[model samples]
Target: MSKLVSENISTLRPYEPGKPIDELERELGISNSIKLASNENPLGPSPKAVEAMQSLLAEAHMYPDGAAFRLREAVSKKFDIPMNEIITGNGSNELLTLAARTFACPGENAVISDYGFVAYKIVLTAANVPFTSVPVQPGFEQDLNALAAACDQNTKLLFLANPNNPTGTYVGRKALENFLKEVPPHVIVVLDEAYVEYADADDYTSGLELRGLRERLLVFRTFSKCYGLGGMRVGFGVGPTELIDYMNRIREPFNVNILAQAAGAAALFDQDFVERTVKANAESMVLFKRALEDMELKYTPSQTNFLLVEMPEADKPLGGAVYQAMLRHGVITRPMAGYGLPNHLRITLGTPAQMERCVGALKAALEEVQ
Candidate 1:
């Protein structure tokens, strides 16, 4: 079996997702556990999307529209981009891998931020494309200068996670513009904006705004985060027509299910629902930050709907212990050891009730660990 597997795939470690609520409850023999690990919308799916999915239940037996025609049109109208520039996927995760598969080769390399989304490294490694990880700057933000310096003629893809996961930090518009200018024309730049809808920073720029600036620029968006459609597994990529065409050619037929397409298209039109989610997240973020401050704990200021909290130093590493303590108390948060931040935890902001529960659990967990 080892001999049958490619060396790259054989050595690769699979991604570790956040523990599901049911699985954690079963393990601990507990009920009503709240999950703030994966950055999912706590308000649940949009009402419009739900109605659309319900309407499509009778049509589940039919195959999905391979081109995602209605969804693509919806996205185009919303973003003001041409329909040909869009390519839908099972999720943005698949599109990220598809981009690498379409553009990079074994000997060529890709550039990614050290603390960027873990999926980028996984996809590149699985495809046998070596990748250079540019170390993050102060405050856990992506080092655009370092990324530009790391790329050379052999670099094929560059993955930048704006409002990066685990850290929840982002780059400003001017910095991104300058960085784009420095990047060579041959290198494809991928902006993973899964959490863009929640960003409230004055300087944050959506890669969608830079569509014609660089022919190789690919912006990935998802229905998973702000749109509350993670279970549906639908996302899309916006890039030049040629790049989108290449990705579409290699993508699996009916990659996105009929329900996902219907839900995603409906979600796109439900701007009011999205606005409510974002507004709720903003209020919750403030609550979490204030609670952390009151407890004398440190955290990164975030543009997205999550925070990266640093646990107090103890006799040993506190992140894992704190995470375990929180889990035992029916609250689930992500320990950042896998992202090389053993002292930190990534917590997704939920509703006010959920946030209050999480903060209470955190205080209790700290007391126990300390």
Candidate 2:
């Protein structure tokens, strides 16, 4: 093997996505199984987006606009940010990678919570950059104070999930403002809001309002969440024009396909559908909480689309047991042992019917084994 390849590539562990419905069904030898594993919109892609993409499918052979013109303009207008401040990505995950490569270098480091979005950590490692992992507070909340304390002169990047994946705990606007006050000028913070549309708390930071301070803060969002364009693989980042412009130079010219560009632009205009998804998430999260409470299962109060349920000490591993049970019952949920939460599982908020079936399956699974 050529020594030209960086050793960083070998040590990196690949990301494990939520199992696909077909794969699960084929493995289990069943049909009509419901998936609550991926934090995807159970409502599927938006009608408007789907229609737009279907029309553009014939042009698939054509290269995508590297600039992602219309989609960028749509996102900029929706958030009231300048066109110059936005950059599109294959997905927000690629944006995270771009940040690590654009800002941090071999000797530099980034700061991330111990159990934050897996993408941030994965990206940092891929760039061969060192990072400090701050432990999440009890109930999986980001410990901003601890993270602040962890920062040193070598730290060039900071990554956080607004409503963290798996945990779904959010840092309020006031807290974020306070933390930003002390954030060093040299340190750039990337706030990943993959599920921002689902957050209902009054104190939740939209990352939209932080545009004025773009020099130090970059807000990442995706069409994959409430916008229902996950299949299109479209997402964008907002930051100070100065910083975003620098990252833009490194992006592939045809990174975003024409269909994704078209669908993303249309999805932005589908305001009513977006509202409905957000409303549904808010409503279903309430029912999920009530059901967990009724069953005496301890779970963190989530403002995001998913709920993280903590399991009790048991003979079998929490990840293996609940996952197997849910699979057996045709309800798929994510086990988060990879983020170091071996005792917890992350369940995405599906449709009301799906949630009802999932909870029932989970309860039955617990009963069957324990």
Instruction: Give per-model CA RMSD.
Output: 1.1, 1.6
Candidate 1: regions farther than 4 A off? none
lDDT of 1 by residue, 107-222 (tens): 79999998889999899988889999999878887889999999998999999989888789999899988888889989999999999998888999998877657778999999
Which residue pairs in candidate 2 collide?
A: 66-253
Q: What is residue 76's positional error in candidate 2, in angstroms?
A: 1.8
lDDT, candidate 2, 277-336, per-residue tens: 998888888898898889888898887788988776687667668788888889888988
Each prediction's TM-score versus the true structure? 0.98, 0.96
TM-score for predicted model 1 compared with the true structure: 0.98
lDDT of each: 0.92, 0.85
